[model samples]
Target: MRVVSLVPSLTEAVAVTLPGVLVGATEWCTHPAGLDVARIGGTKNPDVPAIVALRPDLVLANEEENRAPDLAALRAAGIEVLVTEVRELPQAIRELDRALRACGASARPRWLDEAETAWLRLPPLQGRLRAVVPIWRRPWMVLGRATFAGDLLARLGVDNVYADHAERYPRVPLDELRGTRPDLVVLPDEPYRFTPDDGPEAFEAPAVLVSGRHLTWYGPSLGEAAGVLATALGR
Candidate 1:
C-alpha cells in the first residue's frame, strides 16, 4: 500500500515501521535520517497536485500539523486521507496503532511497544515545577491548553503556566509570561530553535534546552523522551 504522509511524526512512524510503503512525505518530515521519498512540500501548504500525482493509496495527516483546506482538496481529488488527532501521549500511541493497521501493518512495531513502556515506566515526579514553555520566539507563542507538549510535561510533573488558556498555542506578551513567575522555563529546539544563550537570557527562571522531537514528536523518539526530558529537567 502506497502512503503519503503530511505530518512529520506520523511520517517517521510509517517510514520506520513499514519501510518502502511511504512513497511521499512533506518536506518537514525529516526522520530516518536518509529518507528518499518524494517531497510534497510543507505541512501547512502541501502541493496538492504533486501529492495526487503520486497515486498513493493512503494520505496521512494530523489535525494540527496540516491545513484543513489541503486535506479537503486531497479528498476532493478522490484520494483516501487518514487524519489523526493526537493531543496526548496515550492518544498518540492509540492513533499510531490505528494508522498502522489502516495502512496494512500486520503487527505492532517494537518501537511502538518500547515508546509505551518508556512513558509508562517513568518514575512519579518527586516534586512539581510550574513552567512556561515557549514554542516560538518572534511573537512569543507558548504552549497553552490541551497541547500534547503540555500534557507530556504534566506527566513528568511539570505544570504549564497557561494550561487553562483558551487557545492551544497562544501568542502572549513577553511581559505576561515573565509576570507568571514560573519556576522553570523549558525551551524546545524547533518551531524557533531556542538555545541556552538565546532563550535563557530572556527569563528570570532558569531555562533548559531540550530536543523538540522528544518533547513534541509522537513516534519512535517517544521511547527516549522520558529519560531525555528527565535528565534535562534534573539539570
Candidate 2:
C-alpha cells in the first residue's frame, strides 16, 4: 500500500516500520536519514496537488501538526486520509498501532514494544522540578495545559509552570514567563530551533537543550527518550 505522511513523527513510524510503503512525506519529516521519498511540503502548508499526484492509497496526518484545510482538500480529492490524535504517550502508541494496521502493516514493530517498555520502566521521580518550557521566541509561545510535551515532562519529574493554563500552546510575554520563576527551563530544537546561544540567556534558570524528536515525536524515538531526556535533564 502506498502512503503519504504529513506528520513528521508518523512519517518516521511508517518509514521505519514498513520501509518502501512510504511514497511521499512532508519536507519537515526528516528521519531515517537518507529517506528518498517525494517531498510534499511543510506540515502547515502542504502541497495538495503534489500529494494528490502521488496517488497514495493512504495519507497519514495528525490533528495537531497538520492544518484542517489541507486535510479537507486531500479528502475532497478522494484520498483516504488517516488522521491520528495523540495528546499523550499512551494515546500516541495506540494511534500508531491503528495507523500501521490501516496501512496494511503485517505485524507490530518491535520499536513500539520497546518504546512502551522504556516509558513504563522509568523509575519514579524522587522530587519534581518546576519548569517553564518555551517552544518559540520573538512573540514567545509556551507549552500550556494538556500538551503532550507537558505530560512527558511530568513523567520525567519536570512540572510545567503553565500546565494549568487554558490553551495548550499559549503565547505569553517573555517577562511573564520569567515571572513564573521556574527551577529549570527546558528547550527543544524544533518548531523554532531553540539553541544554547539563543534561548538560555533570557531565562534566570538553567536551560537545557533537548532533542525535539525525543521530547515531541512519538515514533521509534520514544524507546530512547527516557534515557536521553533523563540524561539531558541531569537525572
Candidate 3:
C-alpha cells in the first residue's frame, strides 16, 4: 500500500514496520534517520495538493497532531484516512500495530522484546522525585496529564507534579514551579533548549537535560527510550 503519514510518531512507526509502503510524509515527521520522503509541511498544516497528487491508498494521521480542516478536506475528497490518537504508551503500541496491520505487514523488530526485558530490569525507586518536564521554553510550557511525556515519566516511577493539571501542555509560570518545589527538573532538548543559566540557580533541586524524543516519541523508539529512561531514573 502507498501511504502518506501525517503524524510524526506514526511516521516513525511506519518507517520501521512498513518502510517501502510510506510514499510521503510531513517534513517534521522525522525518524529512522535520513527518510527521503516528500515533505507535507508540519503536523497541523499538511500539503493537501501534494498529498492528493500522491494518490495514496491510505493517509495516516493523528487527532492530536493534525488540524481538523485539513483532515476534513481529505475526507471530503473521498480519500481513506486513518486517524490515531495516543494518550499513553499502550495506546501508542496498539496504534502502531494497527497501522502495520493495515499495510499487511507481519514482521516486527526485536525492540519489543528489548523493551520488555528493560522493563523487568528496572529497580524500584528508593525515593521517587517530583519533576517538571518542560517541552517548550519562552512561553514556558510543561508536560501535564494525558501526554506521552507524562506517561513515560509515570512508567519510570517519577511523579509528574503537573499531572494534576487539566491542560496537556500548559505555559507555566516560573514562580509556580518554585511553589511546587520539585526534587528534579527535567528540561527537554527539543522545541527549546534550556541552559544552566535558564533559572537553574533559582531551582530548589538538581536539573537534568534530556532528549525529548526518548521521553516523548512513542513507537519502535520506545525500546531505546526505555533503556535510556531506566538509566536516567535508575528505575
- Tens digits of lDDT, candidate 2, 123-199: 86789899999999988999999888888898899999999999999999999999999999999998889987999
Q: Please write out the lDDT profile of model 3 over residues 1-235, one tens digit for every residue.
A: 8899897777887887766888889888768799888887888889898899888889998888888899999888878899887888777777777777776678555665565456556666676778987776667788888887887788787888999898888889878877888888887766676667764565677787777678877677777887787676555
Residue 235 of model 3, lDDT score:
58
> Between candidates 1 and 3, which one is better according to lDDT?
1
Q: In candidate 3, residue 78 scores what lDDT? A: 77
- What's the true lDDT of residue 128 in model 1? 91
Q: Cα lDDT of model 1 overall? A: 0.93
Better of 1 and 3 by TM-score: 1
Each prediction's TM-score against the native? 0.98, 0.98, 0.91
lDDT of each: 0.93, 0.92, 0.78
User: What lDDT score is found at residue 5 in candidate 1?
Assistant: 95
